[model samples]
Target: MTSGTADSGRVRSGLRGAAWLLPAAIVLVALNFRGPIVAPAPVIGDIRADLGMTATVAGLLTTIPVLCFALATPFASWVIARFTAERAVSLSLVIVLVGTVVRSIPHEAALLIGTAVIGIGITIGNVVIPVVIRRDTSPERVGLVTGVYTSALNIGSMTTSLGTAPIAAAWGWPIAIAVWGVLALIAAAAWTYTVGAGAAWRGSDHDSEPLPVTGPIDQVLDTGSVRTATEQRAAVIETLPHPAKRWVTWGLMLAFGGQAFSYYALTAWIPTLLHDEIGFDTASSGASSSVFQILAVVGALGVPVLANRFRPRVIIVLVAFFWLAMPLGLLIAPQLWLLWSVLGGAAQGGGITIIFIVIVRLVSNDDDARRMSAFVQGGGYLLGSAGPLVAGALHGATGGWTAPLLTVLVAVLLLGVVGSVSARKVR
Candidate 1:
C-alpha cells in the first residue's frame, strides 16, 4: 500500500483504541464514587471508639456526603455547561483525591471535612457521567454503557465493604481508608487525558458548545438548537411538560427519593446494626454488608435485562417488596441476615438502575434527560440525606433498633407507591 493508506490505517487503529478508553474512563470514575463512602462503614466502630464519637456524630460521617450530593446536583449541571463533562469529571476526581487524603488524618474534624469534600466530588461525577455516556456512545450502545457504569458503582461499594476491615486489621483503618485515594488519582489522570482529548477529537459542534447555564429549563429542553428562554420553555412545555405539572415525573422523583433514602440509611448503619443489635462480631458484620453489596452488583446488571422483558413498573414494584423484606426480616427474625442481605442488595441495585432508566425514557432527548436528572437527583438526595441522621438520632434516643428499622420500612413503602405511578406505560 501507499504511504497515505498506511497513515490512514494507523489513524483508524488509533480511533479504535480511543473508543475503548472512554468507557473505561467512565467505569473507572464511577468506581471511585461509592468506595469512599462505603469504606468507613467496615471500620466505623474503630473510628468511633478511637475518636470518642457518639452514634449521632458517627452517623454524620455518612450523612454529610449524601447531603453534598443533594446540594451539588444543580451545580453539577451548571459546571458541565461551563466546563464540559470531561473537565468537570476530572476536577471532581481531584476533589475526591484531596478529600480522601484529608479524611485519613485520624481526627474528628478532618474526617467530617474530608468526607464532605469527597461527597462534592462524587456528586459532580454522578451528574456528568450519564451525560458523557449519552454524548459519547452510539444510540444502540447507550443501555450497555449505562449498565457498565452502574455496575462499577456497586463493585466499588463491594470492594470497600469487604476489604476495608481486613486492611484495617493489618495496618490501620486510616491507612485502609486513605489508600483509596490512589485509585482516585489514577482515575483523574486517565480522565484528563482520555475524556478531555477525546472531546476535542469529536469536534466543536453543538455537543461542544457550552449549554446556557442560567434559564427556566430552556436549553435543556431543546438539543437541536439554542432558543430564547421563553421559546425553549414553550417548546418544552408543549412537548414534555414541566416537572411540576407532570404528576408522573413527581411520582418518579419521590420514588427515586425513597429508594435513595433507604439505601443510604441501610449502608450507613448495616454493619452497626448487625454487630450491635444481632451480636455479630465486626468481621461478621462487615461480611454481611459485603454480601449486600455483592448481590447489588448482580441486581444492577440483571434488572435492566428484565426491564426489557417486563413492564418497568412491575419490576419496580417487585423490587420494592424485596426492599421491604430487609427491615421486616431484621425485626422479626434477626438470624436470617444472609437472606435479608441478598434481598436488600438485589432490590437496591435493580431499583436504582430502573429509576435512572425511567428518567432517561421519560424524556424525549439528551437535553431533557439532563434537566430531569438534575431535578430528580438534586431533590432526591436532599430527601435521602435525612435518613441516616434521623435513624442515628432515633437509635441514640430509644436505645434500641426498633425505630431505625421502622424508618427503613416506611421509606420502602413510599418508594413503592411513587414508583408504581412513574412506571405506568406512557402513551
Candidate 2:
C-alpha cells in the first residue's frame, strides 16, 4: 500500500479510538450530574432533623437545582465559549467536589451553600453536554449516544437514591452525601484525558475534510473556534433568522416542560404518596420510590432504540399513555401502586429520551442543536419549576391526593398534544 494511504488510514483509526473515549467520558459526566442531586433527597429527613432546618428551608435543597437548571442553561453556551466545553465541564466537576465536601461539614449553612454550588455545576453540565454530543458523534449514532447518555443519568440517580438511605444508616448522611464526590472526581479525570486526547487528534488530523454543512445550524456547529462565543452567537443569529418562531421548537419546549413537570412533581412527592395514600410503611415507601428511579433506566435505554426504528409519534403516544396511566392508576387503583410507580418511571425516562432525540432531529447542525437545546431546556425547565409547588398547593387545598393526581393528568394530556406536534417532520 502507498505511504500516503497508510498515513490517512492511521489518522482515521486514531480518530475512531478517540471517538469511543469521548462517549465513555460523556457517560461518566452524565452519571455524576444527577447522583449528587439525588443523594440529598433520600437523606433529606436526616439532614432536616440534624440541621434543625424547617421543611420550607429543606425543600430548597431539591428545588435549588431545578431552578439553576432553568436559569443557568441559557448562559451555558457562554461558558462553553469561555473555557471550551471540555474545560467548562471539568471545572464543573471541581465545583461539585467542593460543594460535596462543604456540605459534608455537618453545618446547616454549609449544607445549603454547598448544594446550591453543586446545582450550578450540574446546570452547566446539563446544558453543554448535548451540544458536545452533537458535535462529537456521527449523525446516525446521535440517537444511540443520547440513549446511553440518558441511561447513565438515570443510573446515577437510581444508585444514590437507593443507596443513600442504607449508607446513611450505616455511616451517616453527611458521609453518604460526600461519597458521590469521589465519582465526580473520577469523571473529571476522565473528561480531562478526553479533552487532551481530542486536541491531539484534531492537531494530527488537521488535513482531514470538515463535515458538510447542510443548513444554518450546521454552520453554527462548524464554528468550533472562530474568535469569541459572542461572535458565534451573532453569526448564528444572522444566519438562522427566527429560531423561536419555529412551531417544532415550541412543541419541543412544551413536551420538554411536560416531562420535567411530571418527573419533578413525582420525585418530590412519590414517597409521601406511597406512605399516606397507598398505605405503605416508611421503609416500603422509600423502597417503592427507588424502584421508580431504577425502572426509569430501563425506559431511557429502550425508548431511543424504538424511537429510531418505529414512528416517533407512536413512541410519543406510548409515553403519553404511560403518563396518563400513572396518575389514573394512583387515583383509581391505589392497591396497585407498584405498577403505577413503574409506569411513571418508565414514562419519565423514555419521555426525556424522546424529547432529546426530537431536539437533535429538529436541527441539522451542532449550533442549532445547542441553541435549540438551550432554549428548550432553559425555558421549559423554567416553566416546569412550578409543578411541585402547584401539586403541593392542590393537595393542601383539598387535603387529599385527588387534586394533585388530577393536576398531573392535565399535564400529561398537554404532553400528548405538544409531543405529537414535536414528533412531526420539519424542514
User: Please, what is the TM-score per model?
Assistant: 0.86, 0.87
On residues 264-318, what C-alpha lDDT tens digit does candidate 1 reach at each position?
A: 8989888888888678888778878888887877778887677767888888888
Candidate 2 residue pairs in backbone clash: none
In candidate 2, clashing pairs total 0
Off by over 4 Å in 1: 1-19, 196-245
Tens digits of per-residue lDDT for model 2, 1-427 = 6654454334432324487898898889988887776677766777878888865566666667777778887667678666776777887788788888988889988888898888788878887888777767766787888888888888888888777778888999889888888899889889888887877876776545432223454455554443544555566667764558777788888888888777777776776687787676544666678777878877888887797677777788888898788899989998888888788888878888888877777675556767788888887777666677777667767788998888888878778888887786731
Each candidate: what lDDT?
0.80, 0.76
Best-performing candidate as measured by lDDT: 1
Write down the lDDT that model 1 would get.
0.80
Candidate 1 displacement at residue 161 in angstroms: 1.0
Q: RMSD (Cα, Å) of candidate 1?
A: 6.2
